[model samples]
Target: MQPLILHIPHASTHIPFKDGYLVGEELLQQEINKLTDWYTDDLFDSPEDITIKADFSRIFCDVERFVDDQQEVMAQYGMGMLYTHTDAGQRMREVNPTLRKQIKEEYYLPHHQKLEVAVKKQLDQFGHALMVDCHSFTDIPFERDLNKKVPRPDINIGTDPFHTSQTLQDLTLEFFTSRGFSVGLNWPYSGTMVPMAYYQKNRQVQSILIEVNRKLYLDAVTCTRNRHFNEIKSVLNQYLHLIRSNVNDIFYPINNES
Candidate 1:
């Protein structure tokens, strides 16, 4: 068991649309800059053996969402499995059922399948898997964001009632706060990622979403890492160490002394 599986769903600016459904290249780049979790993948680095990253941008296909619209809440906002609107609540492109289905099959399903495989492999070997859902948000919330009015903290830890363990949650909060980060629990964003099959059924599949606010380490205007980039990454490395060291204590008490 690798003990940790980092699930980085965003951070790619590559939008592979050769047809040019978007109005202009400038608009596309604006949307990408606004929506992409810029430099988050680098910030959330760790020595985890299992990592499932989506190389394609979320604007193309959001793998974290439920494939079925009825089950996905973000579908109402036109930002479900396949985005129908931009972050500013404007039309990005028209996605018909056929296109939606194609995107789902091509990008969405494959990323999730990889995640499922990684998680199951860990569970089979160690009887437990700790999934760290990595993400980052802008300091200013987008127009389409549900919690636009809420002031997001420097570090937001999203958790699911079913899959997030209390011990892991406590350690996570402590780790970030001790480093002088203002932490929020599911404020700007809620819901942690768990493979749909084991989502509500398996308690051994522990998961947590660590959302770092971009203002801390990213130059929002230029879409680049600031001087604080390495500082934040170093702190995250320490945080990972803490979580890894206590894996036995938190998830496998029987092997605490082993």
Candidate 2:
């Protein structure tokens, strides 16, 4: 059966300009400048794939479109442009955490809810499903990027690794390392983004979070997709195959759904 994989495209904080939203902004040149120096150059100065730039461009465009306004979109981040005169922006800054939580529930809860429906539908036909939640983070946190970005790590494979079986954890670590990734065991982000969000409904639903460092795929400042991205994707394919073969042996399903 084809696995039910749901990749969550990153939703970053919106930057509110005093004027308002910048519609249909082209960001390729901005990315080209920011990406030329950092991790991309360090890993692969020259890569064979031509499609890598396209991926970055797509993400750049979509982010602008997704959060189309200041008041509404900035709320997604519990932040706003500096407005010393206005209470709304200051209020947004003050209750940021609470607002952020609410936004997560608003945005992510629906995603999970939809996923539960979709996975269950797939299960009705296939009897089981596998979900690999895909994400990318930075090697280090970007604290003051004009473009607000949550800090990330080189690699984080979150699967409730401590709570679950050791064999599965080992397989995941070894498999990813073998597939050409510098791996980590939840140093930056823990298991909640994985099993807790999408796979929380039941153990029958096997879930693994693949947190790739943004450095692995793109430029930090420009939001450019790295030349090496295609290589990473290729390696991931092989790793996924290994997981598919060993699902029965490795995944210990938590069948009890709350």
Candidate 3:
């Protein structure tokens, strides 16, 4: 089995249950349309890699946010684990303690458990694991986005100081830049996903976040694939193949010692 875990967190638009929502169905749908990372699951799909995707929409519960609001930077804007406000700072949901706890138990915890299990399985089998946190961001900045820079790069590579080796970083840059795509190193968004169990504790479990610009593959307004979609998908597939082929060289001394 490949020692890779693909984490696609915000791809779904399904809302299992609707409670505490302040907006009507029409408004809620609009928010979902705006926030959902459309087609990311399909874009990052790889039969060889283990994929852990959230079944529900991020508007319901964002698994990426830190469980505790205090630890999450976005929480201050009311866009934490359970979003209470929309990108425009509009009240979207009424998240009381009970509802927060319920969502945590129902959605947040279970999703994380799956990630932990996948990482552990890879480590046990291969002595090293690589997590590719796959995501696509809007070319236009959201109202609440910290960075307001226009003309975003084609790709954003998020990394952790310890988990992302210099070699891996260089290879990722080369892979994208060589194809004539502009790249950003932790620019608009930052940080790769690591299961809490091994986060900052294990170097063998490596991770890198690949955020593709929506303009590259989608018509952002319509939320549909554009002319470049297929070409972008093909390029991403090649990227996955590149990483898999160089797994040994990327992991290096760890595999050597093993």
Best by lDDT: 3
lDDT of 1: 0.83
Query: Better model by TM-score, 1 or 2?
Result: 1
Candidate 1 is scored at a TM of: 0.94
Estimate candidate 3's alpha-carbon lDDT, on a 0 to 1 scale: 0.89
Best-to-worst ranking by TM-score: 3, 1, 2
Deviating ranges (above 4 Å) for candidate 2: 9-110, 144-153, 161-165, 192-201, 252-258
On a 0 to 100 scale, what is the lDDT of residue 39 in model 3? 92
Q: Model 1 Cα displacement at 16 (Å)?
A: 2.4
Model 1 CA lDDT for position 148? 78
Task: List, residue by residue over 3-53, the lDDT tens digit for candidate 2.
Answer: 434444333223222122222233423322322222322232223211111
Q: Which regions of candidate 3 are displaced past 4 Å?
A: 253-258
